[model samples]
Target chain A: MSLTYGAIGWNRQKKIYDLVLACGIVLYLSLFIGLGAWLNPGATVETLLIRGFGTCALLLLHIVLIIGPLCRIDARFLPLLYNRRHLGVTTFIMGLAHAGLAIFQFHALGDLNPFVSLLVSNTRFFSLPDFPFQQLGFGALVILFLMASTSHDFWLANLSAPVWKRLHMSVYAAYALLIAHVTLGVLQAETNPLLAAALGAGLASVISLHLVSGSREVRADSHSSLSSFDGAGEFVDVCSVDEIAEKRARIVTLAGERVAVFKYDGKISVLSNVCQHQNGPLGEGRIVDGCVTCPWHGFQYLPDSGASPPPFIERVPTFRVKVDGGRVLVNPRPLPPGTRVEPARIDANASG
Target chain B: MITFAKWKLAIFGIYLVIGAVFAVVFLAIGIARVDPAAKGSPIGFRLLIFPGVVALWPYLLSRWIGGEHAPRTERNSHRDGSGGADQ
Candidate 1:
């Protein structure tokens, strides 16, 4: 209670504090009296605990994914994001409880070993021949483990922002896994058509939003490429020395894709105009300390290499550029696919 | 004067939490007569079964709360940026 988060735009934090406190009280009451004592189908303490935790974990995953697009679609929904981590961690804890109790309930029935049951529990290794839905959640559980474990800034700092961002990008994969887990495991295993459809619909909403939103960025990239001056082959449009101010980037469209061409320290560098993460428009982002930092997700790209800083394996396509007679021109011809280029020499930089 | 969407979501959160907690608790205690009263109630029954009630709690809560969250703005960028990244 001693910690106080300072005011951030119209004292929003304080209101959230009050609201969350109220919610917490509600949670306490609901859990204590309404939640009642645990009941088991077979009616054992272990069984009840396991079921309770599993339910919590699945539900938490659903809620966590829902929050992001929710707030984006509506600013008022922003309150949910503040406490999203708590929800995710809570789910992990619930999942752990379920897994723990399950070990006792199913595997530890009489004389079976705990560790043996986990790995040996119906693991379907391939999707070609009947995918294992339970194993799918297990995979989700692994990503969640990494995400939840590394949620703090300590790990983030230790991993460096680039590495941390790369690690977190794995959540998209985790989301895909959970969808499979629910579709195959929950729907297939449980045979609950309504819940399955509902879960599917919910996931589809997110995916659809991403698809709808994502395609626009893609289209924008394509649009930029087609609309702008083409500098295919050797012709390039490197910005003039005077055109770029410090920390600002101008986007160039070549061959129907948007690429943010940055000028920093008298050097011209090109990076994909579309952010790989969430497709944040790179043109809108600015350079920070010689690195192009994405306003969204704080993803940083070395304008020179288009590769994320060390310990991070993410990359974006970079292009060659040249300034022609006071006009900036970029070569539409991309460097070889998967080419990771470091600082290319600019005439201005060479003169300097 | 609060917005209707906020009001709806709040109501949804309240009702969902109520419904989920009740349902989960009911499932945990209703079906089987197992009792773990080591603390206060009694120390009679000591069997275990997986109560499915808890898992559905969050989902129901999300449905209730998030379900009623009336889709507000219809802006194009809203679809892309979505407020999750703002804070």
Candidate 2:
């Protein structure tokens, strides 16, 4: 969405989002530290802070993980997906704070370097009772740091979306490692059934959300393939013009890629369903200001040219489309990105 | 805390040394060469990606040496399969 890079591309919405996020984080930390001190009078303030930051980070990470699938399940959750990188970066900072405090308390006073001590201070990896849980936490933190450092679009542009996506997808690995870090580290010491149950519940919820949304995607892809597919070199009959609400799109898979057939202003525009930003679902987006707006980050592309309006350079592929007998038919092949394709005009009487 | 093993210490030393050296070179010369957008980007932005560049120095070094730039090829299953634009 920006022509040049800066520290952040903050807008009014982002400023508000960050303000709310900061307040929530401050509120959570204060409450957690206060409650911890009240419950465990023997624990030091540093210990309470370490636990508070660690738990807060974990909770924020869960929210970060949940936002993606939640949006997929229901577009109503799209706003949460908008500023997710900010949440992710905040999560990493919290994790880093916790690690910093823990290292200073446990390892820094010794003769060995803190990181060196962290790695070698525990070699009980084979024993479940005395596992190197801190190391697991450290591993997870490294993954998180990598993700956090590269969270900006600068990296996304340089890394390319696919490579960037693959790197960020290691969040699952980090989550798994943290689960082990928690289960083996704290759960081993804290014999609270409540903690174990909570961890299990969190894991189950994440898994369940992914499964439900993933199956829905699979079903959609399968449906598109089965119902609309025609042989190559032929226009595939996708859906009736009426099936797509005005200013919205009906997604169809043609020749193995999804395209969004949009109906607006008595015409139809078919475009690749991939958002140039983050590969977000363009089909799920509505036309805003006469341009197809990506629901994820609000990146917009002209329906006709598949290019962002002037001064923004992002583009997506366009498709050849037409309407006959009120049925929308689209060529299975994608034109070059930013290629202009005249929209098929809808017959007012037939569409009615 | 435990006593450091010799090999572990050596490995850590090597990493820090290489990381320190690479950090200077990358911030000064490599990033703008590798990515045009990084050219004239703010100091904070360079600092932001510093840890990643340090950690990924070897891979990035390969890219830098090869004068490779990752074209923003919007690869999807459909695009790859269909020979779509910029594939």
Candidate 3:
């Protein structure tokens, strides 16, 4: 049907984020030359390629994991939710580079040899007694390769979020396999007890934090602190004007929910207590460099429009506020972004 | 993003262990072989975990950990429906 201006703004923001990522990728990859000189101590093209690709693969994994909770904790993360496929594809490219170097560094020789080192290197796959087991890591890496190759928007769009989600759910499977990859291959081939334990613990910790956070969120969903504001058509009584300082703000409970009302530059404004992003309380948050920041995700909003920063257009409705004779009155009338209203101006010169 | 506090210290501990393992293994291999240079592959190899671990971690974590909590309970979402919010 019809396209809203908010939609247009989101498209533009995506483009800006993409461009910045492109610049970063280029700059980061170019540093291989400097790294080769420092790390290898002698100039060799093979060493440079292998080390660079290895580092790239590691970094890509971090970026891929970062986007999800970021959005969950904050509503502003919705924009990135749509662009997640791009991130997947990027991670896949890094995996390809790592694999390419791996083949070249260890397995390449002049012939139609079929590159047997892939399955044959450690000899653990033969299942004979005293086998090294690193062969399992090789197989696991192959599975990782397949998963990486399919990471794309074409697949996600065609598969739908659930099927796509199910397929990507294999990441945990892939993670388990990668753990086998490290323990079976790197630990056995490398033969260092401390390193093996360290790698195992690292992956374990990441997984554990996820499990704990997931459990906490399960309980958190049933309750909303703002539920009291559930509209018996009753306004929450916070305090007298004497209690609120000049050019400042105070918070109160209305219904079961919280609301923040600010008297700034002698004008009154009201907004939801929680941030549209990470649920950061507007009451505890502050005006930083002129805009209100959520403290949790740094989401900023203007009191009047409740619109997010430029290049981003998500908006939260602003409610009506009135100061009647010395009493504060808040009507739960929320206007969509761009609505203009005249607010009563307090005398800047008056002390009380 | 990562909560970045506890996760980091754990990762650091992991790195130290892996590094020490590589160092010890390479040393042992060097000592065992009479001519280590001739028999052993000089190529230093470490673990290469596929890139997707980073990408998939957040989505899985949030899905399992964060759940689908309503973004903010501000306006009545179903204002058009009866008894939801006074328009």
Ranking by DockQ: 2, 3, 1
Q: How well does each candidate superpose onto the true structure, as a TM-score?
A: 0.44, 0.93, 0.43
Q: Could you say which candidate leads in TM-score? A: 2
DockQ of each: 0.01, 0.49, 0.02
Among incorrect, acceptable, medium and high, the docking class of model 2 is acceptable
Q: How well does candidate 2 score on lDDT at residue A29?
A: 95
Of 2 and 3, the candidate ranking higher by DockQ: 2
The interface RMSD for candidate 1 is: 23.5
lDDT of candidates 1 onward, in order: 0.54, 0.86, 0.49
Docking outcome class, model 3:
incorrect
DockQ of prediction 2: 0.49
Worst 10 residues of 2 chain A by lDDT: A225-234
RMSD of 1: 19.7
lDDT of 1 by residue, A1-352 (tens): 0011111212466467446645753464345333435321344555445544565566567667766656545546655665565566566666666666665666677543444454455556665345646556667776776676655432333334566568777877877886776666546545547776767677777777666655665665554453345445455544565676666787656644567777776566776665544455566578987678765445577787666676554445666666555455666655532255554445644442
Ranking by TM-score: 2, 1, 3
* Candidate 3 chain A weakest lDDT stretch, 10 residues: A1-10
lDDT (Cα, tens digit) per residue for candidate 1, span B1-87: 224435655675686577556554533443222211111321111111111223234432343344332212111222222221211
The candidate that achieves the highest lDDT relative to the unseen native structure: 2
lDDT, candidate 2, at A37: 85
**First chain TM-score in every candidate?**
0.51, 0.96, 0.50
